[model samples]
Target: MKTFTKLAFLGIFAATGIIIAGATAAQDAPAKLGDLEVTGAFTKAMLPGQPVGGGYFTIKNNGKSDDMLVSVSSPVAGTVEMHEMAMQGEVMKMRKLDTGIAIPAGKTVELTPGGLHLMFLKVKEPFKQGGKVPVTLSFEKAGKVDITLPVEAAGPGGHEHK
Candidate 1:
């Protein structure tokens, strides 16, 4: 009877640990506001002395009307500006998007690298891996939604290679 009790106790402890780990992983899950869903929000780690940073994400609109991502703000930066990168006569040019990005109804808009993205101006501290950046997203019709963007490695690719 004593041996059986110890085995049961160990099993219960292991199950509890698994449950806690799952909850932590879900912290970065997608966020929904009305008919819109935001996912894959993250930023790359920045080197020291870097004055700017970039943020990326994907927005899905499911409503009958269009929505516009008017502005974005972050706690770690003095200001966040919407921007886009394009080719200007064989030279890559980055431009500020004063009008913001549009998310049409029943369509998906992706703010990614080398395209539409957020520019973190005058960063207080360089972003480091494993840090979470808090941001507020304002929509023309959907109002505002607060989300956290996880900081990842500076290198590209979803996962780091050995």
Candidate 2:
């Protein structure tokens, strides 16, 4: 009776270990860009024939040195440029910046609307809401990281986190 009980307990423990391992594997199944951490990601609604779309996200520098975000690429758009918005004279101007935005060491840089954002111009098709867009964000030091941008409804915010 003692031998049978020990064998049953070991079997149960082994099964639990396998279950936990499976869960962890599923969480990391997506394609990764680099070691940079991405948070608070969101994007505006997409409309047919719209000239551009904007994406906002927060990046955190976990390393000791600072890094620059050089560019972005997306399959849904023909061109993805790092852009900044400002008021030039009486007009609100959006300018494409060839150089990427810099993030300080141990600091979080937010790319929000009306600020530094990724401009998705000349979209190939309408980005359907509640869909997924694969975006590759390239950085100077972190190299490139691929992330899935989840499309949301026409709203004021996307996915936000503290």
Candidate 3:
């Protein structure tokens, strides 16, 4: 009878610990802002002597009206700009989109390599892999959203290590 009581006590203690841990993890999960959802945000690890870095993410708009991503800013970079890459004839060109990228109503927009992305110019320090960088994104309708960009390997198609 004593052994049975002790076993029951241990089971209750283990169940309580799991419940607490699950609750804490749920609190850390990402949250949506009304009709906007931002996910899979990350930046590439900086290369040696490279002053520029790229940030990529996915933005989903669930509202009835369209939204535009106007600007992006980061303390680690001197300046951040929204840019688009395209091929014109035989030449490859990249240009800044001052007007911002549009996120259509009920559609998702992706900022990835070789396409629409955020350019971090004049970085204060090289971004290291397995690190997190904070950035603020300004949307025409969504207002300003703060997110952490996880740093991954030094490649055009790199996944967040964290």
Candidate 4:
């Protein structure tokens, strides 16, 4: 009788362990960023009929020496370009650069509004609130890094959480 009880208890414990593990595996997994360390990411709220959208993220250089971001691509937009808003003559103009942005060694470069950003133009679908867009950023030395930017409603600023 004791042997029978022990066998049944072992079977029950094994089944329960498997059930717990299966439930845990169903949750969303952590996002993977290749080569570079990504932090302090946010995207401005997009509106319908808006010609362009912007994506912002902080890229940290972990390796020795500096690196340059060559390009960025995404399926959400027709084209992704590196742009800078600067004063040329008397008016501020947004100019697209042929080369990519640069990041210094042991320092973080930020891509934010009115600064270095990914210009997502000709969006296929209307960017709705609470949606996520996947973008792949390629660097000269760091290779390629994948990031997802969350779309939010129109607000004063990005909602950041530590």
The best candidate by lDDT is 1
Tell me model 2's lDDT, rounded to 2 decimals: 0.63
* Residue-level lDDT tens digits of model 1 in 1-162: 012243453353243221101111212678888988998787777766666777877899999999999999988899999987654444455678888899999999877765678889988898887888899999999989988888766554453211
What is the number of residue pairs that collide in model 2?
A: 4
User: Which candidate leads the pack in TM-score?
Assistant: 1
User: What total of clashing residue pairs does each candidate reach?
Assistant: 0, 4, 0, 0
Q: In candidate 1, list every pair of residues with a backbone clash.
A: none
Lowest summed-lDDT stretch of 10 residues in model 4? 18-27
Sum up the clashes in candidate 4.
0
Q: What does candidate 2 score on TM? A: 0.70
Q: In candidate 1, how many Å is residue 153 off?
A: 0.7
Better of 2 and 4 by lDDT: 2
Candidate 4 C-alpha lDDT tens digits along 71-129: 98989899999876544444445567678888888787767554566778887875665
Evaluated at residue 25, the lDDT of candidate 1 is: 20
- Model 2, position 130, has a per-residue lDDT of 67
Worst 10 residues of 1 by lDDT: 17-26
Give the Å error, residue 65, model 1.
0.5
Model 2 Cα lDDT, one tens digit per residue, 75-157: 89999988775544444455678888998887988776555778787888766666666788888987888776666554433
If the candidates were sorted by their lDDT against the true structure, best first, what order would they fall in?
Answer: 1, 3, 2, 4
Candidate 3, residues 64-105, lDDT tens digits: the string is 999998888999999999987654554445688989999999
